[model samples]
Target chain A: MKCGLVAADGAVLHRETRPTPRVVVDARGGGRAVLEALLETVVELGQKAAADGHRVRAVGVVVPGIINAESGIVSAENLAWAGTPVLAELKAAIGDQHVILAHDVRAGGYAELRQGALIGTTNSLFLPLGTGIAAAMVVDGSLVSGDGYAGELGHTRFVNGEAAELCACGQWGCLETVASAAALARRYGVRSGRVVDGAREVLELLAQGDPDAEAVWKEALAALVDALVMYTTLVAPTRIAIGGGLVGAGETLLAPLREGVAARLTFQRKPEIVAAVLGEEAGCLGAALMAWDSITDESGEQTV
Target chain B: MKCGLVAADGAVLHRETRPTPRVVVDARGGGRAVLEALLETVVELGQKAAADGHRVRAVGVVVPGIINAESGIVSAENLAWAGTPVLAELKAAIGDQHVILAHDVRAGGYAELRQGALIGTTNSLFLPLGTGIAAAMVVDGSLVSGDGYAGELGHTRFVNGEAAELCACGQWGCLETVASAAALARRYGVRSGRVVDGAREVLELLAQGDPDAEAVWKEALAALVDALVMYTTLVAPTRIAIGGGLVGAGETLLAPLREGVAARLTFQRKPEIVAAVLGEEAGCLGAALMAWDSITDESGEQTV
Candidate 1:
């Protein structure tokens, strides 16, 4: 987990990384252990801030899941959380303080909208090609929450016919099956009949002009292009910020996407494809900003 | 055209239809004639309202193209309008209390949301498969305008590779190429080599167990299913209200779509697919409602 003390002026005073505790028994569910680690991180950070003569105003926590902002319940498949009352626990741990619960990708998008590549755009998309894929949609100057269920662009089908593969979400031909970082590593290994470390090794192979890497890269590019074109046709975003692990390839990934989407768009307005600026620290920074905005005070009094 | 004066309580106080004047010269744009006819209609309607001792507070016009809400410019290919100053022209004709310009399909969706199938649902879709296909998206209890460019689901590519055909929007394999009412008639004609009158004849042929009609219908159903599933995965709408001429076939059209979408969706929320209730008058009613909403009052003065 990436945690940080971000000031009002968007300055990072201090930052740290911590391990997420794994659930010992799958039968009992892994959510509690994860929640406990989160709580510990927040408490320790507050203590550190006080010692350093800083008064913490609010707490913002970003999780990779659907956030029921009203109920403060979160459900994430990777984290093994099912309707976990994370907001209630956070409130209990730090009484009477404003706590903001948000989707991790959306928080990252907020950071980008405020201070990164997507700044000044009302209609845009923030997509991260990580181990999995999801999107943060900005429509008419507001991030579309879709009642905590919108912006699953990766899950939309791109691959067709027999070439299609099943996704973790139990859907076939999802964009994540081809364009994501994990898919890159998996496809490269399958095509070459040899296992590599991860997408990093695949990127290195691509740099060396490996045929198998090129084939998988081309396939990923086609699917990404299809996804972007479809998204542009339906939502009409003015810009799209590409982030997450796969963006480490920089121009290698973005260049082809820009070209393919450009060639495919007919009557639609062209969206500027760019790399995300905040990188890995975006979610943490966005969380701090949201928490601060949720309540207007440094007095530790709850307004909402 | 179906024109109406709707009360704030959603009552149709006065309604009428008029012949649409066609443009004369091939060199001259048809937009000028269309705009003149529209201006005449609004002016005459206001005069009629005053003679009836009713006050005209707002004027709402719904058109079949991109309505630039900020600039009040309209650009519709079918209407031969490109960046036409429709709102300014309308305000000049009728001294505006409030003048609203909106897309016809979206206005129909607004009427549905206000008084029809989508009344209670916040997250929903109003899709009409007429001569063309378009969608009106309801997300977070508000209609998504996407700055007049969103909800072009018909233009999104569904058919890929060799099976793709060119769309009027200059794209290939758009859902509208196969799933729209006009497409159904066209495909049936192409498949059987017999020119059918319209989608109505195709539906009749389908009821009579024509093989070619069945094939085209199945193709349309397949594409529509893909489009709906894609929409459900991305936007997470709770209900989908299907409108337009194709809905006339009733259960024969709706049941297949519901089944196909149900079978294809994996982890996504299943939207209830139902036929729209407002019929052809929806656009006119929606325009009136929008005009009423744009301002605060009706002072009971019967001013023309």
Candidate 2:
């Protein structure tokens, strides 16, 4: 992805293009190959940028799954890597420069907190319901990593009925199984025997008032509301930023969801539910911020 | 309830019984009369302890609902308290002593994390499923109270088909309505016209092979497992401590619930489910710890 860095002070500086590395295919091989590949890509990009007269002080990599930021270990289920020393690899590739590795959703959440829907909000939950369900937390002006395993919202169980559908994580009735974009398509296929390509088609069908699509859409909305209600009850953040492929439904998803959650809350404060402003640029922006943080010293100020 | 505190180091302390004050009713009248009474009791107890030559440096009070520790404001639907300045009131009554106010479940969780079922575990959830469901998080030896509203687990929605039950919180199909101890009793009343006094009687009936009791019990277990499965996917805790009224069912509850959760979890690590060790005393013990922390100086050593 070719991306430009936007500083906190609204200064635009430097442009770089780097290939997103393929995630590990096998759970074995000890993550050495995957880490090596990631390092090589960053180094190549850094060299190109430097030759073009742009100084690249740091590199940021976003990965899916559990991450221990303090230990620099990535434990992503989708990736074949577990406990891979990503920080060391990035440093070895770029040589003495800073490297920041963060959970993709959390990084996205940072983008939202800084420049998007969650701006000026101290407490918020950023959940991206895509191929899977995961979330990020920004509490008291700081993102909570909790040893790099803070936000995993998708796996919470949403259904208590029989195991009609099994989640990819092997859990039955997980919120992800019912609320994600993939779940919308799967539910449609199960009910009507037509395999849709993505959640967008289902949304289009629902807009046209297709009964099957409407039913599937409502089900997914209910599931999403279930998770959000629980989150509201627990954290009661000032706002909740919904992103990822599923959120592309936009107001079609946001309006009813807000109403549903509002109907549930009585004494608890109702948080504003809004669409993410960062769009697809969230991860890259968050990476840049983290990279900036890496180079800064003890006063905790980021000078990019 | 008259209570005794056992410190983390196994030192036992006693507080003599006295009637809770009636003055709090003047500040907020009616059903909240009990809460005021409890607060008054805490103040009276603190004064008496000081008069008895015990150096009481801090006071910890645990209440139900959403609490903001930093601001000392409490909001609980069940208690009908919105923005109650509990810490201020207690501080006024108890003189210069530091007052620590915490959510009841989180306090219970603190007790478990320090000395009970969750001992030595880095990440654990303490759930007290009584009149309502609330959870406490202990991550890496620190209690996670995201703005003091981090443990409201009962509000998580539980969707099952189209027939959704309305929750007391005004939400439809909340997990508490289906899985809490009160929920079990309520289900028994609706299903078989049996007015069970509490979850204890319902469990008794289930043990006696009563079909209605068995059905309701199974439903509760399913709902609980569903919620836990979702929680595990997100936080991936090392253990989950089940406390409160429902946990009184003991092995009967823990055994089947564990099996159910394990069966549902496929890719995630299966956390051990167990009964809380501190039992009824968890809240008090936890409060004391919080009180101790409030008074302890910066060197990380306790003076009281």
Relative to the true structure, how large is the alpha-carbon lDDT of every model?
A: 0.88, 0.74
In order of the candidates, what TM-score does chain B achieve? 0.96, 0.89
For each prediction in turn, the share of the native Cα contacts (below 8 Å between chains A and B) that it retains comes to 0.80, 0.70
The 10-residue segment of model 1 chain A with minimum total lDDT is A295-304
Write the residue-wise lDDT of candidate 2 on B182-240 in tens digits.
88899998999979998889988998999999998888887788778777766668799
**Which candidate number has the best DockQ?**
1
Residue pairs that clash (backbone atoms under 3 angstroms), model 1? none
TM-score of each: 0.96, 0.85
**Candidate 1 structure, TM-score to reference:** 0.96
lDDT score, candidate 1, position B233: 87
Q: Write the per-residue lDDT of candidate 1 for residues B164-203, one digit (tens) a residue.
A: 8899999999999999999999999988999999999999
